[model samples]
Target: MFSRKTRLAVAIAAACSFNQALAAEQEQLELDAQTVVGSADESAVDSYRSTPSSAATKLDLTPRQTPQSISTLTRAQLDDFHLDSVNDALKMATGIQVQEVETDRTYYTARGFDITNFQYDGIGIPFVYGNVEGDIDTAVFERVEVIRGANGLMSGTGNPSATINFVRKRPTATPQARIDLTGGSWDKRRIDADVSGALTAAGNIRGRAVYAHENKNSYLDRYSREKNVFHGVLEFDLSDSTLFSIGHTLQKSDSNSPLWGALPLNFSDGSKTDYSRSTSTSADWAYWDVQENRTFAELAHDLGNGWQAKAVVTHVKKEGDGSLFYVYGTPDRDSGLGLFSYPSEYQDENRQLIGDLQLNGAFALGGRQHDAVLGASWSRSELEDISWYDTTTGTALPPLEDWSGNIGKPLNDAGSNGSDFTDRMQSFYGAARWSLTDRLSLITGARVVDVESSGGNYGSDKTTKYSGEVVPYAGVVFDLTEQYSVYASYTEVFDPQTETDASGSRLAPVEGVNYEAGIKGELFDDRVNLALAVFRTEQDNVAEMAGMVGGRSYYRAVEGLTSEGYELEISGELLPGLQAMAGYTFVDITDANDDHAVTYSPKHMFKAATTYRVPGLEQLKVGASLNWQDEVYNGIAEQDAYAVVNLMASYDIDPNWTVSANLNNLTDEKYLTSLYWTQAYYAAPRNASMSVSWKY
Candidate 1:
């Protein structure tokens, strides 16, 4: 646990040292680059999407080529939209909704279910409810790909809603470099730099390095943060068909006086608007610090005979220390609001390891074309969490300076104790596709998974791992014309429940089925891509939150839950001088057991953006985007819908120099971005930023 004063001192020292090192490194790099000119393109999109020097598997396989629905967010889209974080990028995607829990915590949902499973370069990283941190930054990724429906084939035992994959940027055979600096309101400042080039004269080896730093103040009092990140990758071409890559990432973050829990919504009169934006209760002396390190290695081989093999291994370690403040109910809600308050301190450490292998190839059957894939994966994770609580007796007694020294003793009789948990999973799967004709295809897949968990304060017990249901998939794609196609697909997914009952028995896994039909087209000489899709999803044996009546979380099995939706999306270059990307979704989620609308699903969600270069000013480019979501209830209580507008402008001062500005929440709208059963969190206020970049 860190105190505010100590954390601030440490941050200052680190920043000073970092700046000195950066200056020295910049000078050295500049001198070396001046001696030789690089051939790589300096454009952000080109650099981000450059083909890997090492031969790798292509991601654009047809629905028939793969037994799943895959979606991608490209680097061009990220740059056009100015997406700075993973949360910012996902909100614009189809069939995905991101809910904000706190300033630093976010929850992801898809197909009317929460998505708790994630992967980096196809390596598993499991996440639990109570403890979530160490999120990866978008700066280090090349692209994001999502597999809709169940992904037991690769993720082992996990959520069926969706499986997210983040592809790390790898080094390129061509040399390139870029640097950007940004400053904005709330004393915000950020810098990002990327450099990549061939590591060997023969071009058999390449390497890439990226560094990013961000510091800013938040809307809440005494809330501020600083983050530092570094990413590096090396690639080697063992042969023309075989390649290997290794990468590592390190991140450190510090937050001043983070809040433990949100304030309750209602007062004595049961009115919802009883809280004040300026209300103060959190001790100014509290602080939080987090550190994360991750590394991975991957190898791929392409057998000229239409066969390919790939393997990946990854490991991650994270640790955190912090003090947080939580607000509780008072005896007299109307009169003694400040009398009831509790502060807690926590320390946590987590580590994970994962391995994956896959083989894919094409074969012929019954005079028709067929593609097949077989894969297996294993993962293990361990976590330790400890916490201490203090309860003060008076109603505003000591000053901020003395709060830490004159605190009460621990509240829990268990004293300063901790809990340790471990989770392990193994899975094997196979899938194949049959092309009935040049215009039609059939796809199917199945998987078996075994998962185990143990080691907690209540003692450890392992249940005989049960096999997951056999998932089946089918799809059809018809090429209507050179530029148009129609597709339909059905997929099934299952998610095992790790939570145990009072008798320590594992609950049945949840089952999900999805139906989808869509059309995809390319116009304007294959420059523009557009799609429209209608979809429906149903889940069986859904896990429902029962209640937390006595400080313990409880859940029950619900029979049926259903979600249906339609989406429209347009991407790629729209015109010679103009480019645009946009999407709209209409969702209707319901609790099939009661036929009531699901609490968190929005009815309408939309996003659109376009960028165009000024006719006379070739260096000037301007863009604007709109984001909106219809009203949805918070639990059973209704909340108002909200929308926000964002604007961006960039000017190329020269071929190697550029400047850009961005404005978010342009209207200064006040609305809740997300709400829990009894609480709401405000969206970010209107903010603006300007940045300068130089590339070589």
Candidate 2:
């Protein structure tokens, strides 16, 4: 119940009714006098735009001053659109594609490449290989920031796509509380609560806590899930010029009858196969469960004379266990009897500890003042996994038209094997922003890193390490005027691969470089923002799948791959009562052979969302969002361009109470989740959710 869907007819009718909201919006207010007032860590209260962002360089800079493309999903926008999950929020974010490849595993891509770097509160990068195995809730986050293109100065291994930073909410100086209950189609039920305030009489100590729980059935037969998220943080003022903070976050999800892979997209004859959207290839005994725990501590101090020091320490643990069933083979279109099913049991555990120290301040040089930061970071991670299975594997024979999840689970204790790996990283980085003149600035950064992979993983055949690797970053910005600026940047990063070649030898790490230029501006006295950017990226030693051998899949490293793209985005208070965000992206990828490659990634994408408070009715608001992408090919088959519309409306019962409703897939559009492989699945159909919330 991705919030559960209303009955089919009801959902369609309600969604169609919302079409009027978009066409009837009146002229909005433009108050050029509105000013930004808040810390960059916190979102601007009730605004769609952000205050300032350091997502690009550790130094805080306004969007117009940054030399890269950045997008943010703020708290107010999340609440207005009912985006409670990370997947849903990223779906509407500019220039990002949320690929839900399976029931629980998802992949995110931007600018024609996969995104592998993720940050928590601007600290600790979680290393993932294009996929995340469990659901991520937004209840504990103040905002989601996306830095597109290559960013090596911060997120190590600067994958050429994008980096996602989930900023956790901090304790507030004033007391506040909120409770929400939501119900959606497919019997989806969810509850969320958030509370924050000062814990001491003198207000020297503050605490904040958030919790969310959800239970729901899916559009697919025999599929269901339960999820819970809990987060808490405490901030203490050691002195008038110093602060200390500690926090912990826990997220868990358990799913029943989840698919291991997906359905075959083609039959024996090579023609694309068609199945009902509600079809499932899962057995009743299959289940997948995952949990993530994060604990962190941070300290900050003002050293006087415009100098500051900060330190952060963090630990993360993730565990997963699954009993999965996979359907493989090219089934006959008429008989559907050529497919085979295999079942297996898997368990995995991952633990990581990371820490960093940073010192920053203002310095005067030859008649000009500038800002600079120096940092040192270290990280250690260990991973363990096991695969257990029964003996029966290639058995075939079942009628697809009359199949149900009645299969019994096989004893998985027959055999077991696994892998263990340990990895470590150490790096030193520094960056500075020099104001050469009143309208010109120069930004430069550098990182020296040493990384090693000591133990062999599931597919690796040897120990791998890279020492004394250097990543460089440079950018220059020239203000055309007080409200506009033009900038250009160059950066580099490297990524290690886990996939091996036909000889079972690990492939070389991928190295990438990027060149980008953009024009940024503010309108209506900075109430509105606009950006236009173009970028080109080149990579070497990219891993690509090769033929299988001895029951094992292998990959080969390809060199000289290129990707080029452009983007346009605008977000802010277009009017006094109207807030809006819109963006368009186009990208082209060329393989080593100089041909269009990675067809699974579309060449064009467009996303837009807007919310309006009624002019005459101050207590009511309505919003609509659209996501569209051009056709994509999986090397085997192609899917046509598709668009999904979402509508939201809310009424304030009073200052402390409100009721809201959201409808997604308004036109009941049918689409595939992804074309990554020959096996794929359909996305959920039209769905709706209604909620009641109380705030104090």
Candidate 3:
């Protein structure tokens, strides 16, 4: 795997050199991507609706033209709601569920499956292993784009749920600067600053910088956090048709008394135990610290023949250190004497590198114009962990009625070992959009992947490899009228597994298929967009645990696990000064036996947010958002259906000044973020924040 990636890197370098030479000799052509920015098909910053998307097929197609579901969180929307974290921003996106399983570990799901494919500016490889640790701030992102369904064209692992792409903020042709100061509930305080403009005369060279600092205490006892973020970028226009861009980002978060695991919700009697939202099971000596450094470079060239060549390279380093304590065992309701504490100290470091090269352009076929794209990409991730055990590995704790975050710091009393591993993927992919007729079109793409993983987890030796696996995609769209289109598509993804069969033989990789159809409409002169989509996903070769053999567990391949659902979404300006977005989603999951499966995922969800500029007083805008979902059950516990309301109001003091406020969970709803696990933490209660900003 390593040698193959080395060869791929050399090939990409050669392609970059050729692209640079061609760019220097050719005249500049009309290039929408002269720099790192969103395409014209992207939704504007001031509107809630999007026009077109390239995240799925790499071909610019309007929502009405693309045979899939899409959602976008624009800069305007982010600022309006003060969505400071990536997790917070996704809460407003349609069909998304943010599972906050721990203070630092989170899982995101869409359409009844985990979303493992993440991208930056359309380049893949993010959050390896399907979990978000620590915090991911949104200060440096210009917009967040979501494609809800299988996307095998760009991602190596095409999860049959969704793909998230973050577009970074870039230097602008005109100079601009902004500063923001905010204070919120839970003793939260933050400041952010951003500036972007030219670095030299004639605007041939440009740069942008962003910085943010935050300090806050959580509603939970013994929990607080401090964070700092910085990002800087430089753009060099070597030639009129060529752009070379490089950027670096650093984000660090220090959390005190972070929760390694959640508290059990039930006692030994199988009855529920109610706990206050502020209750915690962390020790005063517990702390978790995380830091990440990211660097990326991009080169784009317009080939003068309407063809464009682009190359992107990204590298990331993340480190986590913590001393944690976990309390386990169902306590006796009468005496609260059954719980025990398990303590440990640990550190981990992860590194990831990815590179891609691609060419896209228009070609003539039978005297008709068509769009095509060819690309290759390679990515590798490595992780190393070191740890030491504690003094209270199995010590019983005090009674629950007197429980508090009071524990002694252990002195490396237990032994520890190293756990190191690596994951690699290399793929070549292509796609084309054929305008078969003026009103009908066909879009097709496929990706061939090479994947491998070798590592030791704790004390277990694991290795998996797959060579030359092909994932296919197909879609077609028929425009019934200038304002409406109907489309259908078949998409697929492959997920390698390590589970072995009862015969001690490795099972085949899991295969996923998605069948989808939808109708989309663009009305009111492209100001409003609406869509209704129905989708069903089938997964096969899923490993199911069989009876233990020789004191070890073996598995058998199971198929027929399926999920089907429909979604309705509408977004845009409903009135001259009113911008709104609303969506409804329904999903049903069943196993091979036709019994409910993954019931933790709500079958029905409705999310809506709208802001209205007061009549004749455009400077004053007020809005409210509501998220409602049906009851959820995880085979162990159940959470009743609930709703959360959030309110926002902002006023423009002047052209250069503004003040805003936000109130969350207005109903103070008490509910778990998820019931996917027997032990889950409660979501936050009512909270408010106020902010002021200045622009120049």
Candidate 4:
């Protein structure tokens, strides 16, 4: 971490340089309110103008005005591209890296670190753990926004990679309804319904509801999944200047014979094992299930003088239960005999509560008009897990005669254990954007955070608390012309570690400092946005898992890591009826000595997607996307570079009816999505889906 004196010096120098440039163009600049275009309503999904975003700075700033790299996957984009799940959507995003640790466990990384922060409707929430198989269904969301950099101003504790913000679908003043049915390969079936309108004739109360169900079988033998989602929201206009909204969301997921891990890659003889793409190592009895519920309320009041006060509260409860059978041990090339089955069952419950209150307004300061936001937030998350493992020693289950899909379930019922974890955080944060001139602006913010975590095995507990940690943020943006802007930003983040030093004393938290500079352009009346940025992130006290001590595993926090990367992105309407989005990323990460490289993250990635409507046949539209990534390395193996392309087409049969079809993995490229020391997970092959919809 940089010293306070150094940070201050850097900020002052950047401010002076930006101020000088602003003065040169002070006489020819004009500032106007950021564009507020049409809403991302249900029917309009192809436009790419990202405006009035509250995720990046909690202010009315367009993507071009925000200092960080931000991306929004709008409803149109999701629907047109058939991004059904959070994982699927993120894979199409630029500069994002998704790793599948297991069939159900996934992780997202950017700028060389894991993304551990998330939000819903501008409210902070616990990080989404991939092991839970909770995808945060998109049926209830209007868009998914991502900020790729440190965001400690609002997120109290996290990494510097990225923060995800989910914007919920809101009640509309106009009546609307839609229904859709879909069928696809593997006997996949899906149904969806959405309705929104004013509930009262006076137009003081509005409501929206969404319902969806899906069931599908996978290529893996005997594996199937079913999921359901329900979302409802209501808005009340308490008074002319006051509004209140309440909502509820419920989701359930169930899977049969789910695979815990991929098949082994090598045999005991050191020869590579070639398994079919449809191979499964899971027993017929293995299953995974999850249930989640959330209730939330928000109040907003105008405080006069262009100021507003808002308050939000949310409660979330989630339960996960699953049984897993893992296949281990290197097998003999000929007999396939050395493998052993380790069966386990687990159940867990997670409950969380979050509250936030903020005030925002525009004020005159230092002879300039400025915008500022002040907020305070509190959150608590509690988790409890119970697990049972097979401990029958001596004899193992009969060895497999052949690698077939049929395997008998084991019954051991030998050992059991439980654990509980709780996390609490309270923070006060504030930020202001000062318009030094019509063409120049300076943004700065800070957060004072206090966080604590307590948990342990059933019989013992340990508590760690971090207090009075202050994270600062600053940025400068200067408009070089009406269509071009350049900016620089610095942000800090801190992550609490569970590791202890050699003396058994817990080490200090991991510290990260991120530096970024970029250029932005807005063309065609701000309908098209483009950006190019270069960034470097420094980390100190990075923790690495070490050997066991005193019968318990620990970590060493003496390691240092650094990452440097550059990204170029373009998104918006390319023509009258054509929308396009494209991005390319390059990243390099190394250890303290700059020799050993980080694993699992690709060095180069490129993504492009476009949709075009027939100029005359306006009812017909076609879209396609291409995702390419450079080679990636795991500790045990390396995966060659690969590219996957997808195509989609939609035709409106009439004013109220439409049909769509999507084809994924058009080339049926075979590749590995993840690699472990002994196993490898392969990507799915070609698949197709078609849907029919009606709206009124």
Candidate 4: tens digits of C-alpha lDDT, residues 357-387? 9999999988888999999999988889886
User: How accurate locally, in lDDT, is each candidate?
Assistant: 0.65, 0.82, 0.82, 0.77
TM-score per candidate: 0.85, 0.92, 0.91, 0.89
Error of 4 at 214 (Å): 0.3
Q: Which regions of candidate 4 deviate over 4 angstroms?
A: 1-44, 128-132, 269-272, 392-401, 404-412, 457-460, 497-508, 543-558, 676-678
In angstroms, how far off is 85's CA in candidate 1? 1.9
Q: 2 or 4: which has the higher TM-score? A: 2
How many steric clashes between backbone atoms does each model show?
0, 5, 0, 1
TM-score, prediction 1: 0.85
**Candidate 3: C-alpha lDDT:** 0.82
Candidate 1 vs candidate 3, TM-score winner: 3
Say what the RMSD of model 4 is. Answer: 12.2
Off by over 4 Å in 1: 1-71, 157-160, 274-281, 330-339, 391-414, 457-464, 498-508, 545-554, 635-637
Q: Give the top-scoring candidate (TM-score).
A: 2
- For model 1, the local distance difference test gives 0.65
